[model samples]
Target: MEPIKILVVDNEEDQRRLIGIILTKFGYSVKTVSSAEAALKDMDSTNYQLIITDLIMPEMDGTELCERIKRKRPEAKVYALTGRVELYDDHKLEKFGFDGIIQKPISMNSLKETIESAVENIRRL
Candidate 1:
């Protein structure tokens, strides 16, 4: 089987690298982008199976990125990472079309399981 291709989008370099390292350790093909705009540009170039992005970004936030990805590539899975969970409700997210959410400062275990679960769910769809 092909290794699952994942895109990690975050404003913080450390955060992007951390997520990339963790996902790469799990045998995923990970690409790290500094912003949602970069993510969008790369989305068409690479066939990413999933995108894990920070909610807050300089431009083209995670929600907008998710929307664009969903519109362009309906099968691409999206996971939002943010420190402010209260900024958006579950129903609001559903409207934006994100597959799931990951709170900031994620642990390896949770990050692994979340990615695994999201990838698995995408496979089933």
Candidate 2:
């Protein structure tokens, strides 16, 4: 069986590296992109099982990225990662079509659980 492919999008090199390393260790095929624009370009060729993007980014934010992704691939599972969780309400996130939200200073357990749950959800669909 092929490993689940996940994209981690973040402007911070450290954050992207940390997420990539952790997901890779967990037996996922992980890719990292520095911006939503890059992520969009990557998506054009790859079908990612899950996409986890930082909520606050330059030019295009995570919500905008999610919107764009959904337009092209409505089945795509996307999660918003942000330190400023207080800034977004559930309605806003739901409107943006995010499958889930991952708070910054991520907990490995939570990240794993979220990813597993998302994969399971995808399989059910």
Candidate 3:
């Protein structure tokens, strides 16, 4: 089977590339974007089933991005990658259409498990 194609959106170059590297090591097709706008543009040409976006950004935040993406592709798995996980509630985030939240200073093992579960869930569907 083809590896899951994922799009990551983060304004921070270091964080974006780091995630790309990690996801690549996991043997997935990973694409990283520095802004939600760029992500949206990329989506116009790519069929990305999974996306990880920073919760905070310049013009458009992750919340808006998530809502827009969900509107366009409700089945897509879009997760929020943030350092301020404590600043928001899971229920609220879910209501806003986030599939999950991945906190900053991420744990590789946990991320791997989370992605594995998401991929498995996608495959099952």
Candidate 4:
């Protein structure tokens, strides 16, 4: 069976690398992009099962990215990652169309559980 693929989008190079490394260690095929625009471009060729994007980005935020992705591929599972966790309320996140939210300074256990849940949900459908 093929390993589940994931895309990590973050403006910070360190953050992207860290996420990629962590997910890869967890037996996932991971790709990292510096911006939402680049991620959209990458999506053109890659069929990523999950996307985890930083909530605050310069040109295009994670919310916008999630919107665009959902428009193009409604089945796509996208998660929001934010350092300022309190800034995004549940309503806002639901309106933004995120499958889940990850607070920065990420908890590996939570990340794994969220991804597993998303994958399992997809499998069920």
State every prediction's TM-score relative to the real structure: 0.95, 0.96, 0.97, 0.95
Model 1 agreement with the true structure over 71-110: per-residue lDDT tens digits = 9999888889988989977778878998888888888998
Candidate that scores best on TM-score: 3
TM-score preference between candidates 2 and 3, better one? 3
Q: Report the lDDT of model 2 for residue 2.
A: 85
RMSD of each: 1.0, 0.9, 0.7, 1.0
Worst 10 residues of 4 by lDDT: 116-125
> CA lDDT of 123 in candidate 2?
79
Q: What is the lDDT of residue 72 in candidate 4?
A: 88
Off by over 4 Å in 2: none
Please give the distance, in angstroms, between residue 20's alpha carbon in candidate 3 and its true position after superposition: 0.6
lDDT (C-alpha) at residue 39 in model 2:
98
Superposed Cα RMSD, model 3? 0.7
lDDT of 4 by residue, 52-117 (tens): 999999999999999999998888889999988889976789898998888889788988888889
The residue pairs that clash in candidate 3, if any, are none
Model 3: lDDT of residue 63: 98
The C-alpha stretches of model 4 lying farther than 4 A from their native spots are none
